[model samples]
Target: MTATDVLFIDDDAAIRQAIQQTLQLEELTTETFDNAASALKILRPDFQGVVLCDFHMPGINGLDLLKAVQQIDESIPVIILTGQGDIGTAVTAMQLGAYDFIEKPFNQDELIELLKHALEKRHLALENRVLKAQLRIFARPGPRLLGGESPKMKRVLSMLENLVDTSADILLSGETGAGKDAIARYIHETSERSQHNFVAINCGAVPENLIESELFGHEAGAFTGAEKKRIGKFEHANKGTIFLDELESMPLALQVRLLRVLEERKVERLGSNVSIGLDVRIIAATKSDLKSKSERGEFREDLYYRLNVIQIDIPPLRERREDIHLLFHHFALIAAARYGRESIPLNKQQIGLLLQHDWPGNVRELRNRAERYVLMGPVALDEIQSAASVDTPTPQSLSDMVDAFERSMIQNALQMCQGSIKDTMEYLGLARKTLYDKMKKHGLDKAQFKEDADHDGL
Candidate 1:
């Protein structure tokens, strides 16, 4: 929607043509629609323009259209076009939520003036909506998502906003430091489930044998270390949400039981036949490509499909470079407050370095740098130069950082592929020769990545 956008609806062709020409002369984009139904298709909650419709049209009249538009977004300005006999109806439309009414045989200048005012109002409404959303996202008492205006981040924020009030199982995919944890927390804290518990578990950190006990708590004397009855994370998160981090690391054997819980919405303690009813929203985060892993038989395909009902991909910091300054300032403010230090602003050269650096660790790395800068001084910015992967950074850090990032990516791919060079190449989109060359360059052995699941009790 643009500044000059106008949705003009009138059954009269002559009147529609006249209005379109008038608005065009006034430099307005009039999208003429004879039927209200057609115009309704284009109308969205975030429409940034005014609407004009004739009162006594065919199927849906101006009053009915006004009601529908209000339902979509009450802030939209709907101007009704009425005749002399329709004055009473026009007043009724106003009471029903119309912005203003225009009489037939009206002066063109007055009509243009009213539309200008309405367009300004529409623009202000949209601006205020964005401002309010930002305030809600960043003004929370606890740690919040470092809000930004970058296009990719804005889409992510918009999707998060829509999900806060809904109880949909969400799967978040991102790199290790890409703020998936923060996003999960943000959703739980801002939603209606805020009063309930938000249980989080790192699937990869727990040992193989005890992982089941940790998740599906046990009864007294159920296992070697079981003493008293205990509740599982799912039980504790009843009527709330449970975040399963590092989901790809979940063992294949446990995945069958996990799938049962998700499908049944129930959880049973170990050594107990009685099933406890559960009502928990599941939010799983995975850094690895679960589909690829499942295809390679490293993860359960059924369970992967079950948890992937709705997925949100968190963009890495390097992809949203436009937001560097905003994120830096946001973290710096929090760091300064915590460290009891002044929030010294970065100079042009320092800011340039911050922008130039390819942030491999995403928000976590930036937050760490901000904290260091607050605790120390300008020398903290120098750490970024030493840690940066780009050429503008120090020569010592540049090659080392790039090589380290590349090595880690290859190692992770190999690990996920279970030492299959073909699968690794497919996953990394690298040629066979190139993959072998890099493996040799990084001194990586395929045998090191292959794990014996049975021996490891996974």
Candidate 2:
């Protein structure tokens, strides 16, 4: 669990010192403030902690500080610490939204127990807020792809939008977990056929013997265990979309049938002479090169041509490294909601580790890690560090080395400036246009850098 810091504010230096020692013994992370004004400076709406303020102070006493803290984030638990026989003041503090009041010369065990409860309340409140925000994101028009202003993603989205209303079959090419299925769903959602069913089947996962029946239904008594007529994916997706994931894994015999269906806009059920016309659009995705497979007789060249009418290639996560922070936070927020925890922001070192590591599993791997981090914070950090330390071949070409250095420098500058393009350009001593050109070339986005810094206080 991620620890929440406690802000202890008291006017008396001796009181602050004593409480600090007590809190340390309790193994609670805390910050001491001599005055309420100083304490309020560090208070923020997103602060993950509780505030403990002295009831009577020279300036801006506990009651007033409570109000200020409420204005920032009413959910934050602010406990009032008062002197002995201050029951009236403590009661008044509770009415004004103070979590609980503890009288000085307070029992150490009771105070610790109260602090633990307050911290738990604060943690729950933060998790609720995160969940609500995630719901708002989901309640938007369509499924989100979680892309920032990176040029590569923007272009891909643009292409998808352009093909949304078209009936042409789409072939999505990218590494595994690059969100080809998501892109397919997005196309279906934004298209005119969204009201109809959108069927999906993993070509590689289905048994070769049953793949044909799965794609184009089996009639009654078609084969053994074919007791009744059933609708296939293609028929079920009539006037909608059918996504064939891992298209390269489809059997060669099935490829011929798929091509015929694409050409004739119809399908024949197993053991049935009648052909059913289809108004469904097809979206095929593959991690392998279908053209190369076709050349090697592993896949049909005619079928490849049929599906490749409108190809959409999704860039892997490594190619669009600048969006890593943004994507990580997006998935982290989701994980936070799923696991009922607050999303831990990645520090500069963590972000650097993410950028340095080669994501062989792509966006899916990043998302899984984000969930793990939400569930087990520092443990995920150790895993990332370990991954970063793995040995990889160094760039042998001078141009490749220069490019690597340039990308790293740009990332460093962006990190330093918190993703402000103007500040980053100034820090890097480059013209705005030059910085933009380089950023575009390297698939870097300044906004994402700033977001990363803001997320974890980098």
Candidate 3:
């Protein structure tokens, strides 16, 4: 809404004409009316802008017009124009819901300023309605796949579809790059709450000090720089889903608050007197060994039990060798589209090499490698390893570090030959039985695990 559509009602044609000319110079759209009755007919809830009317009209007076406009829609601010020495009438107009009273022989500057303020308020009200409408679209289900249709991926999709309708809190456990977030998204997109928000927050990415406030919001003066009230994730996720990634990285204090919310169905916003009710279905994901963390007293035991009510451990890309070709094709096509280039198909050797490497960083690492390959031809083994290593932070102590390094190398060799001991040994420059012995020593299982009916033992 703009001040360009200002409507002026006055019995005198000259006065109405004068006001319109003056407003026209200010780049306003003006409509002059000799009678208030005709003006009321044109006035609507969708009126473009301000309504300026004369106080001493013959039929319906300024006060009567203001009352009628208010009856139609109270949101519209009606300004009453009075003649000189009509101070009592202007006061009466203000009492009767007139936004402002302008005396005749009014300064053009004053009228323009008042009209401008009213137009801004009207514009903001309309903008807020548009914004709320946009939010409704985001609350709906988002796109679910990057690509791929291998048997392994089919099983994952099957599991997601099976679990989507339930109200269970899912715990997605996987390696850092294993696409746990992708699986989480798939569940949310296919679930009953698909029409609601699916908000994701990285537990590890946020600083520990501000994590609580970021998740649960704060009131004005909650702390330094807390100048205004804020809504929290739990509140924002009402009747929706909240994905807490890197769940183990959340501080113990926050873990307690989260557990309480899960158990009691509410949360207390910081620096507030009251607790807010929440209806968010939580889907927490972790890349680390949560059992180990629980044992180390780094993660809360009660919280883990609560979250692990329905756990889904995602296998690394190397473990699902059959899916490599599918993943490669998926990434390749995505890369081509993103880079605006013709899609390039991978050779048998390229697929073989892709399957052979141990993707420590998981699906995310594979996607990055695919993008690199698309941009700069085939990537070298060292370059790919360096890329994966960027997220797989190095271990500190020598003994622990060496063990991790050895595990990675052995895992790579095993994956290279589809778990063939002889081929794996040749790749690792070791004997067949020696490779088997190392596999046993490292507690690496060669058995092919499948998602069974008793998968969660529920």
lDDT of 1 by residue, 1-458 (tens): 13336899999899899999988776566889989999999899877678988988899988889999999999999999888999999999888878999998898999988997887787657655654564465465334566654568878888888899999899999998888888888889889998999899999999999889888888998988788998988999999989999998888899999999999998889999999999898999999999999999999999989888889999888766556655676577556655577878765467667766777788888878888888888888886677565455433455654564566567556644545576689888999899999989877777554321111000
Per-candidate total of colliding backbone pairs: 0, 1, 2
lDDT of predicted model 2: 0.79
Q: How well does candidate 1 score on lDDT at residue 230?
A: 89
After superposition, candidate 1 runs with Cα above 4 Å error: 1-143, 387-458
In angstroms, the error of model 1 at 51 is: 37
In candidate 1, position 241 carries an lDDT of 88
Best by TM-score: 2
Residues 126-199, candidate 3: write the lDDT tens digits.
Answer: 43444354345324453234433234555666777678888788999888777777777777777888889888
Q: lDDT tens digits, residues 1-458, model 2?
A: 32335899887898788888888776566798888898889788877778988888878988889899999999999998887767897898899889999877789899888987887677667756765865675565333455544457778887877899988889999998888877887788789999998889999999999999999998999999999998899999999999999999998888888889988999999999999989999999999998899899899998888778788888887666656766776678777776689886676567667766677788878888888889988688687677567757332455654565577668667755545566677777899899999999988776455333223100
The better candidate by lDDT, 2 or 3, is: 2
**TM-score for each model:** 0.56, 0.62, 0.52
**lDDT for each candidate structure:** 0.79, 0.79, 0.71
